[model samples]
Target chain A: MSNKLLLMGDEAIAQGAIDGGLSGIYAYPGTPSTEIMEYVQNTKQTAELNIHRKWSANEKTAMEAALGMSYAGKRAMVCFKHVGLNVAADAFINASITGVNGGLIVVSADDPSMHSSQNEQDSRFYAKFAMVPILEPSNQQEAYDMAYFGFELSERLNVPVLLRITTRMAHSRAGVQRREGKPQNSLRLPSDPRQFVLLPSIARKNYRKLLMGQAAMEIESEKSSFNELISGNNKSLGIITTGIAYNYLVENYPDQKSPYPVLKICQYPIPRKQVEELYNSCNKVLVLEEGYPIVEEQLKGYLNTGKPVHGRLDGTVPRDGELNPNIVAKVLGMDVAEGQPIPDVVKNRPPSLCQGCGHRDVYEDLNEAMKVYGTGRVFSDIGCYTLGALPPFNAINSCVDMGASITMAKGAADAGLVPAVAVIGDSTFTHSGMTGLLDAINENSPITVIISDNSTTGMTGGQQSSATGKIVDICRGIGVDPNHIRVVTPLKKNHEENVRILKEELAYQGVSVIIPQRECIQTFARRKKSEKKESND
Target chain B: MKNDIILAGVGGQGILSIAAAIGLAAVNSNLYIKQSEVHGMSQRGGDVQSHLRISDKPIASDLIPEGKADMIISVEPMEGLRYLPFLSNSGWLVTNITPYMNIPDYPDINEILAKVKSLKHHIAIDADSIAKEAGSSRASNIVMLGAASLFLDIPFERIEEGIRQLFGKKGDEVVQMNLKALRLGREFSEKNR
Candidate 1:
């Protein structure tokens, strides 16, 4: 074993992919999951190992690039945060039916509790809907091991694997066992054109093959050591826990005296036979899975016995909230000591944009520009700038998802809404907004799409966006008239100019593209530090 | 036995690092520790708190319920008062008296000081001043952590060891500054008591 290093879950996934002999990694950076791609890109071993890493235009392009690599019979991986999955869902759902020529792993780090996200949608459900295997790791070590295994399983099953990690699993640090690196898979040219072609007839055949492959996958799951049956002294109670919840259960068991047998599952399409055997062996079965009761719900249908199943659905564990060790112990009939009461600590601290942030100045200018136009005329996209929807500056009226701003603005303009403006980040514009931009330009919709170009993917930790240097040209190339396009600096000193330009574009009576360019605050800080170091050297 | 500690401070005050150090110390002592942190826009000058649960056995929940903390360590006075509800009635509060209010509309520093004085087991230290004296304002967290050590049974040596391990890679200058800050904080808390 290499030196056992304490690594964050995100870093562990990156290391796991490297150890798993991934040949290509395509990703558009988003938080929690951003570190995975960044780690792989920065590691000295990447070039030594001949790994191909690139920041794609958007999640869809990233997903497609990964699929293309898998088509060449090489291990490929794509990563994005929870919402990025929405941008790539079209390709993601179809890829499940299309299967794969080689190993393919799609990692979606779900942000629970709305941390750095608009919503806390579980990605495991997406995996289930796509009829693919999903793996959720509880800690850094599991994240590493599962990611490695996810690749092998994907190749073995001839299907894409979804490795779903939550914010806790992505950011938390734990000691991980290092392993000797595996050699990259030998490349193989496409043997049959029909495999790549996803016509209805071919897709139907592949879909049936997917169904036929489920039984074998379940058998594989049963034999896999990742899911274990940990038996204790008590036969009356049993606990079925998976992912981080398993860690919570193990940690909460007082005196290590768990009265029940625990079938700890970290992989899914859960080994139903193992769950059944454990269920049959115990008097009462309790499910301790996180996110949704995917395991608990599935076990209910398969069980023939009269034993009652307890879990999220039954309210034994919380159905809507994140789990902790104390909650798990209470459900297990353990008497844990309650600590002293906490005093009232009331302080209302609202989220604020960073000091000297370019988004701040842009929002100020945009608000002024919109005031001239009318109220409720602006639609905003996701990014660091989404905070504009909050106090002091309510420049944006709607923010649903990536690229929603452009489409929503188009919709509002078509309905004769005056001075419709869509504000999106440069990264977001490439992610999913560009298509809507094209639509607006082609249809000559009377709207203004403001691309807040911070020269990076600002919200999710500053990963480079594919359209970093080409947004203006791309807009013009897509039939947006150059005369109608405007670019401005989102600096406090340039506030008046930015507002003036925005107002002019808003009144253009046609699709006008506005590019507000600036550097993200964090990126700017990092660059300053690097420059200082260079000067010192 | 479970030990619930609430570490609170304004964002950017290194409250998370202090909690992380405590969690690492507990883990090193052969105990099971579960830690949950709030992440979002909070790191940008908002109120920040981390829940650190250390037990000889397993911990069940990530959050310590209201009024259940064995100890509350506040890096800032206002931030400490904000998390007081998590502290047991008789629980100890170790905080820096200095006010580091990032947002406008902050309560008067005198009022905050008066409120803290009402607690039975309150130990206030001028951690910011100590850190400044130590030649690095960033070491205020270390100093506050040092002051909090007086109320806990965890050895000063363990904390010293943890600090060393955390700053060891940063080089000798940082290591020396932090060690000085920690020792000064410990001395200030002891003298006040």
Candidate 2:
């Protein structure tokens, strides 16, 4: 445990949580965030410490379950991607007002460059919106230290602390020193039971308390060693850096000395004292932050006394996508003398459906059936099958959120767009699509819900899907006609039959569910490999 | 003293296996290693590259700055070229002469090999055939690591030990197969380079 383990930022956070008295860590698998939970699940510590490490149906469930553990006075952590934060925002925002009985840290791994996400939304804004303190680590060691210290801050403030990280920080590996492990909290309920029950009367007072607590939170940020303004003799330009952006800035100066006075803000509620000193000491201020220019805008809005503040907003840095050291160098007026141009032979390689994938056959049939119905009528949800929206299939019209396909198709059907189709994967269906399907049944909308049952969450590395064996029953239970529910194995031989079935379903006057049942090819391969090993044994 | 390598391949082709082997060896040698990788949707048969930086001194950035990479070890031929921009002008390019034909517009296999052979600092090996000869088709990644090891500063014995440590859990036979694969690659590099 004392050894310096080379760990990804996500892995560091997981270890930090273990060392910080974590009783449970709940999450759904997601890009950039999946490794955090996977590390804990694979670790021997989960069993030794008796911590709860289980996948939830969705991010909201994970958030609420973590809050439930906090309500029992046990430190709990929840990790998810930035988009997953949107899914869990309801519970996340409400948890702030209710506050925590035990330490709780919500780790939202943001994809600033939209590397694997639909958008590049920052989670620090969520922290600000929820009126909670945020810890943004600039390196793997600090990522561990922040997780361990974040729990104490969460407990002391009686609120959930937000641990925000971006893709580079989440995926990049570096050596991290370990901290001493702590014991899990003994189960103890909140002193005031109604503190969580947000009845308007109680909620109003709690809301006021949260508002009145901002000053104290700001004072904590002011006193925090994590928020520091380092001294420099050259005061021509002041640099403000936060999160992984600090690494990019520091990387420009290999000697680790930026002649400019710098304020490195890792723990935030916007340390006004550091900002004041930085602004006063330098001629101009340059802000470096990943994602949206929230910090830059905040400084300009609240503290700007006519001194020029330059960042993403004013074009000091690119407005969109993640920040890199090269861009950082360019902004700092440092020369980047290296790097050759990519040759033309190296063509773009966009992600495609794997060969022999079940979704491939399904999309083929769906595209054939929909060709008669025409394009722009199919609404798909997020998953591997969202790849159908690409290439020769070009099968789906929209893929906005987890379950938006069914609901969006339903709305379109209601608008008299007959034969509207919704294609959603099994895991995504269970995540948020089931409720939309039920609503479609209630209205008897003329929409065909094609639930591609892959028997696992294929997109996020084949986790056990919530809808493994229950898709048909769930549809029937949702009040869809049992006769209209059809299940088919997605294979090339079944293409003609599957297309016929899809055509019939699209022609249906009421709610219909077409269940294309097949195990994901990747999962099948893994199972076959393991079974081969087992048989050899 | 240092090795800045870009491990390139299509997702699901197991470039990470090579990274894992090299990482284990680097750690065993007490060298600082920082590796940055691609995850998520790209795993659905897309182009992927991992930046692996190992040095005797402390490492700073996770990414290998362009034109600073000491070597390019690719499991796919075109994937090796895909990272050409990152490779230093004099860096070694060790690539498998196999084509992962997920894309319809994939350049001709011969064309890829021709370009690779055209380079003064290139070692082209049919790792798949070499791995199969070594007794396991999946050992191609190990063969890649073997080919790459010729350019690395770390000891070959440590990498062989790394293979044992990494694949020993799978079974002794599998570990032995990979060790054989690794040796085949080193022998190939010695003959060809």
Candidate 3:
């Protein structure tokens, strides 16, 4: 055995992919999941592994590249954050219909509680919708093992696998069992060219095959060793836990002795036979799963024994809010120690943009402009800058998703709203906002779209956005008047100038785009440190 | 026996390293251990925390419930106080006395310190100063962890071995400096006790 090493969950996934004989990894940088690709790219030892790694233009492109590689009879992996999945939804859903020729794994790292994300969306539901298998790992080791196994399972089932990890699982470092690398799979062109061709008739036939394949898929899940039954003598209660929820259930029942059978499922869709057997064995089956009641709902339908399945559906577990051990214990009728009362150590600490953050200056100027116009006139997109909706800088009115700001502002303008402003990050504007800008230009909507160009994807880790140096050019290409597209630094030093420029844009009649150019504080700090080293040398 | 520990600090404060060290120690002791951590916003100086569960049997959860943690180790005083809800009434809190001001608005730093001092079962150490004395401020996390190690069943030798395994390749000087800081922290904690 090799010496033990501390590896982050993302790094472990990368290592697992290499060990699983990955031929290629295609991805775009996003928080929590960015390191997976970065690690593979930077590791000197990986050169001998014959891995083809590329940073795709966006999540959709990244996914399609991996699909193409998989179709060539090579194992491939693609990764992106939760919201990036939305950009890749079209490719992801279609791949389900056109089965895989080789191992293919899609790694989606979801940001819950809106930590560095547009919304706290769980990506497991996406897997469910696509009718594909999903694997959620609780810790670093499982993350590594599941990533490797997920690819194997993908090829076995002739389908792509969704390996959903969360913020907690992506970044956390733990001891992973290191394995020797495997030889890269040789590239073999698709034997059946018709499988790659997707006409309406062929697509319809493939879609039916996908539906018919579900029965065997369920049977495969039942026989899989990942789904196990942990039992006690208690027949009055049974708990069905999946992914991280299984971890919570174990922690909650540490000291309690209950007559219940616990079904721990790390893989999905959960085995219907296991749920049916669990229902037959217990009076009530309590479903414990994070994100949504995917397993619980299926159990409710599969268990014909008339046994009550309690979970988020029946309000046993709160429908909203993240679940922890205490919440699980409370539901399980277990006694948890009472925590010491907080002695009002400090007031509630609401998250805010960092001091000297470009977002701060941008919001300050935006707020001033809003005061000049009217409140509730600005539409915001997702990013670290979206915190402008909070107190001390109540600048933005609505924030739906990544590129919704531009569309929302255009919609408002079409509805006869005056001085409509759209606030979006430079990275987000490139991700999906460009299309919205095209629509705005086509309709000649009288709205101002403010692209907060921090030169990085600030909401997630500071990764390079695709439109870093090309915001002005992109806007010009999209038909926004070059003269109307103004750029300014959003800083305390440039506060007056930024506000003046914003005011001018708001007053302009046609579709105007404001490019606020500044660097994120974290990236700026890193740059300063590197420059200092260079200077010292 | 099951031992659950929670480590809290600002992002980039080496909270995960402490958990890794503890996890490594457990692995060395031939115990089953499970640990989990928060990722996003962790690099942005946000409140980052980790749970390390060590048991003779398999660990069920990667998270420890409020008041169930036997020990709460923190790299920052404010972070320690922020996670007070997770500490058992009888649990011990070993943390650095240094305060980290979070982004957005926060209460007076002194007020936060006062509240932490008033809380029972707390031990405050100038871990940052110790680490600085050892020639690097980043080692403060290791120092705080060394202070907290006095309460855990895991032996200091195991911790040292884990540290060696983690950072042994960084060079002898770096390893020796951290070892010195850890020893100094242990001595200070023993003197305080």
Q: What is the DockQ of each candidate?
A: 0.33, 0.58, 0.46
Q: Per-residue lDDT for B5-94 in model 3, tens only?
A: 888887766788888777788788877666767665545556777888777775565677888888889888777776778888788888
lDDT of 3 by residue, A331-382 (tens): 9777877776655654444456777788888888888877867799989987
Between candidates 1 and 3, the TM-score winner: 3
| Second chain TM-score for model 3 | 0.93
Interface RMSD of 3: 3.3
Q: Write the per-residue lDDT of candidate 1 for residues A46-92, one digit (tens) a residue.
A: 98888988898888888999998998999999999888898899999
The lDDT ranking, best first, is: 2, 3, 1
Q: Enumerate residue pairs that collide in model 3.
A: A234-A259, A234-A260, A247-B61
Ten residues in sequence with the least summed lDDT for candidate 3 chain A: A250-259
Best by TM-score: 2
Candidate 2 lDDT score at position B179: 93
What DockQ does model 3 achieve? 0.46
Error of 2 at B14 (Å): 0.5
lDDT at B163 for candidate 1? 84
lDDT of 1 at A139: 67
